[model samples]
Target: MDNQKKQPKPWYKVWWFWILVIIIVLVLGGMMNDSSSSSSSSDRKPKAHKVSPFKRTYKVGQVVNYKGYKFKVNRVKYFSGNSMDTPKSGNQYVICNVTIKNDSHEKQDYNEMDFQLSANGNTTDFGEILTSGNYENNTLDSGSLDKGATVSGNLIGQAKKDAKLKLEYQPSFLDDKTINVNLN
Candidate 1:
């Protein structure tokens, strides 16, 4: 009997090997095609952004409805502090008596910081001066409000005594929309 060893089949000639090679080639080709298409599309100009409509400005004593909340500036009072609690030179305490109501179905947050006082080209944030007499113990507090709950208090700021003022409300940082209340 001849003792010649049988030659092993070449890897390229194996059926399973060819099948795997074909699958790899197909996958690579598909990936290259997808990358080329995406690169071409990236050269196109982006779509224009839609502009938002203008909102109406609310006057003092008018209820402003925004983002499921109701805001009203009842009145604005000026105070020339007594000898013990006077404002800075050429400035006086400007107090805004306001009411906020949560009209949404869920709880909402209320903060004095949400209100800003703008006057004479300057903007002032909500704050309290211990010397300013606490505005009659009715300063607006920061807290969470339940649905339909209401809170009323004073937002105090220091500004020129004769400057026309406006109150701005922007409770959410994610939202750029602001409600302006003219407090001349």
Candidate 2:
């Protein structure tokens, strides 16, 4: 039997190794696995940012700005995108249900909903018109929401890897507001 037989373990077994591993994972992950930069374009959901944009906690009478319009959220629900049942390659979306009250009070029938996405506030040339909607409200009482009426639509914005994204809503016969969204 020879005296020089086994070698010692690599540093990875110790706390220092864990530290190095964590550092490497963070740096490399941030670069590759970043929300906007991941090569896997097929993936529908990205790793969420540290803070969510929806975390603002909207309440009644609180104005929510989408695409370009500011509307009051008398009720909140999952608004289905109403996507075609046919499966398309690498196309995925989520719909947050919303029941909006027409606080404007002018007896408005919202005909069309258009979106304008911006990267770093370049509204002229940025994202696409994610959705063009034909939304109609029978009639909203001024300052009173149609409690059970459902306003359905999807937040349709393209996935841009590793960039700042903004969503704006432009309603044909409604309101408008520039939505602020941050991506990795």
Candidate 3:
């Protein structure tokens, strides 16, 4: 046999070289796809979150309509309890003159207990002290309202003296929606 040397194969023709080229092509294609997708997303405006329609606040004297019933807070008054009944120390009575109109075709039940007073981080519900005060005649009572009928009365609760208060009315026990009236 003659003494002959064989030449090595070129880098592009090697098996490992072709495998590395395929990997690089795949990585570059993935990078390009990611960049294009990000650019497209950045071109569109962001979506806005929706707000609930049932959640709302109203000022005094504004009519709040809920489930075909119309409610209006005519006035707010503060008082010191009478001799027969007195509030706790550093507390006073908050009274709201509210009018409710049944505009629906059917009769609706209403109660003074539906109203609440929130002040100084405390919530006050209708209590016995409210009925014993000098304003007893003005207090609201539980009754059924017929269509086209209107009933106006006072809702009372005890709160801190001179504290800013919010009168809240919840029409139904099962519903979380409330109508808030600010009493400054």
Clashes of each: 0, 20, 0
In the range 1-184, model 3's lDDT, one tens digit per residue, is 9788788999889999999999999999999999998888877856576443257777889888877788888998888777876888998777888999999999998998888888965777865445564577877888999998999988878888878788888878898777777887
Residue-by-residue lDDT tens digits, candidate 2, 1-184: 7799688777767788899889999998887767655556637676656432244534433556432234542332222344533212343222222344344434434321343445455543222233324322221222323433334343333333333444443444243433333222
| Reference-based TM-score of each model | 0.67, 0.30, 0.66
Alpha-carbon lDDT, every model = 0.84, 0.39, 0.82
Judge candidate 3 against the unseen true structure and give its global Cα lDDT, from 0 to 1: 0.82
Backbone clash tally (model 3) = 0
Arranged by lDDT with the best first, the candidates are 1, 3, 2
Which candidate achieves the best TM-score against the true structure? 1
**Cα-based lDDT at residue 8, candidate 1:** 87
Question: Per-residue lDDT tens digits of candidate 1, residues 73-97?
Answer: 9998888788777788998888899
Worst-scoring 10-residue span by lDDT in model 2: 135-144
lDDT score at residue 126, model 2, on the 0-100 scale: 21
Between candidates 2 and 3, the lDDT winner? 3
Candidate number achieving the greatest lDDT relative to the actual structure: 1
Query: Considering summed lDDT, which 10 consecutive residues are worst modelled in model 3?
Result: 45-54
TM-score of decoy 2: 0.30
